[model samples]
Target: MKNNILNSLKNKFEQTKTEEKQIQQYFSTFDFASNEISESDRMFLVEKEQILIKQGKVNSDSLYQICITLLEVSDRFKNNGERKFMKWYEHIGLNKDRVSELLKRAHLYINYPEKKNLISSLPTQSVKILTKKDIELKEVQKILELGYTAVMDIKNNITNLNDDEKIKMKSFKYFDVKSIQKIQKDIKKMDSKEIFNAKKEIEIYKKLLKEAEKQLEEKEKDYDNQNNLKLLEAE
Candidate 1:
């Protein structure tokens, strides 16, 4: 009876593995991208993550480590602030834990272009960065954890902001109305050219804002129309 039970358990495991393989094959065409994530693709990601978890392939700590390492090297993720992070996360449609894992994976992919296959592998989360002293270290994730904004500030050759500039521009998005009023007051302290440039930027932003509002209005109308149709059909 024990031998029969063992055989049954082994068969069940094999069947599960086969199912997981088929699931992966179904989504193999849905390539990962920040902007191109559709509802179906998002569901696929969540399902695949679940299978990976059941198969003992998901490693959270190591994934977090890869993310930290990427912050020190890559520039692809929207780590600029909590707002950007949230928007990006929502766009990707990953659950919190999966987001954290894939976020780390995205970071590693950006920073370590040479290690793409290794980084994507479930068991491999190793990261390496040279210190100022040029020593190669293995335990890199033990260092201080940087916030979302700080991670977004990681610089590269094509990056618009340098290290010092990124620090200076760390963020003004959290400024209060009073602080903004103070900024308005201080703007007169600027020279003429700076004021002129600022005015041009303000005008451009106004136009863009109007366009965004128009787009939102159209979307709302479409949603309302769909809801009305649904109600009529129910009637």
Candidate 2:
């Protein structure tokens, strides 16, 4: 029984590996951006990015090179900060705050020099964990229209607010941490069956989303061609 279970797991793992390779190959040859060469170039750049991330995982030398490249690129387009080096990450997304944090992390490693091994081994997504459990009530009022970034950013500044308000914010944050930790612990404890079901649900959701996109494209293909649509942004 144990041998059978191990074999089953190994087969699943190999299947997942095959799927990932298939995805990468499909994207490599896919004409996702045949219309705009710039978009096609972006795909290759992102592929290099994934390779850098995988390399950075095992080798400190690899990480140091990545950090150096990122920091240099950031500085090269110093004036065009957001426009040049912005990509979305969940929770904090790729906003000004995340950019600031990336620069700060890169500089810390650069200045320390010796800490490159430790810093590089550390996952960048770990930085996104620097979030409060809940936004302060006053912060809730101020950050309403802002997107997910606002959801992550809670103001701790007690400038104009009273002592009672400060205490309230602190208490809320304390509770938030405790609640989030408990939820994460519960999630980690889910059984294999539970985890499998969750993953199956996700696969179903992804297939449905792709089907919807396909249907929409089919329906609008003529309309889009006729309209030659371009979205305008107002300064």
Candidate 3:
């Protein structure tokens, strides 16, 4: 029964027009295979930190929430700053573990700060440290290159596919022909700005698909209800 209620709520939320738009926007920007973050991207991190500092020292709740938001946004781009943020967080007197956990829930990475003082106090040395800028950029470049290769492989297979195969491919609508076409176009252009735009567009499409699925589920439920009512009347 609890599951049913939860499912119902999910269906309703998904069916809403606003939810549909939000989902479309989300998928349009989806870049699942991109590099998380590099050291060169430190400017982004610095900007975020500045925002936190500007927020002024408030009650513990507000401070923690803002920190979590900054951490969450950074993590979404694969630039997890939980450890560094936590170092500063503890310096200001917050629940280190709870804040760390919350950041994880928001899809950020978890690590212990590299500060010798923090390390000495920690129970374990196995904790991963944040990657430096150069290391991070290299990692990003490698991941992007690998993503390009995968896209190429999929493109080759897709081109060879017959009508039956193409129809079967609809099961993975997120990677449909249109998406592949855009990807190929971006590759040909070989511009970082264009690639970023293309990636954002793909994310939007995925969000739209999610919204459409939700709407379809709601319609299915309504249809089921009408059929059930008719059957009861006939009986």
TM-score on alpha carbons, each prediction: 0.24, 0.27, 0.26
Candidate 1 is scored at a TM of 0.24
lDDT of 1 by residue, 1-235 (tens): 9999999999999989997786666544445575678888788787877676545433333444445553543244446565665565445443344444445555555555554444444221122121212322222222212111112222221133335543444454533456446658979688988888778877886688567655665665465345334423543
Candidate structures ordered by TM-score, highest first: 2, 3, 1
**lDDT of candidate 3 at residue 199, scale 0 to 100:** 77
- Each candidate's lDDT (Cα)? 0.48, 0.49, 0.44
lDDT of 1 at 140: 22
Pairs of residues at least 3 apart in sequence or in different chains that clash in candidate 1: none
For model 1, give the 10-residue run with minimal summed lDDT. Answer: 141-150
Tens digits of per-residue lDDT for model 2, 190-227: 89888787678668866885676456545544442222
Candidate 3's TM-score: 0.26
TM-score: the better of candidates 1 and 3: 3
TM-score: model 2 vs. ground truth: 0.27
| Per-residue accuracy of model 3 over 137-226 as CA lDDT, tens digit each | 333233223332222232233333345532555577445566576677769867888778877987997788668755765665465345
- Model 1 alpha-carbon drift over 4 Å, by segment: 1-182
CA shift at 197, candidate 1, in angstroms?
0.8
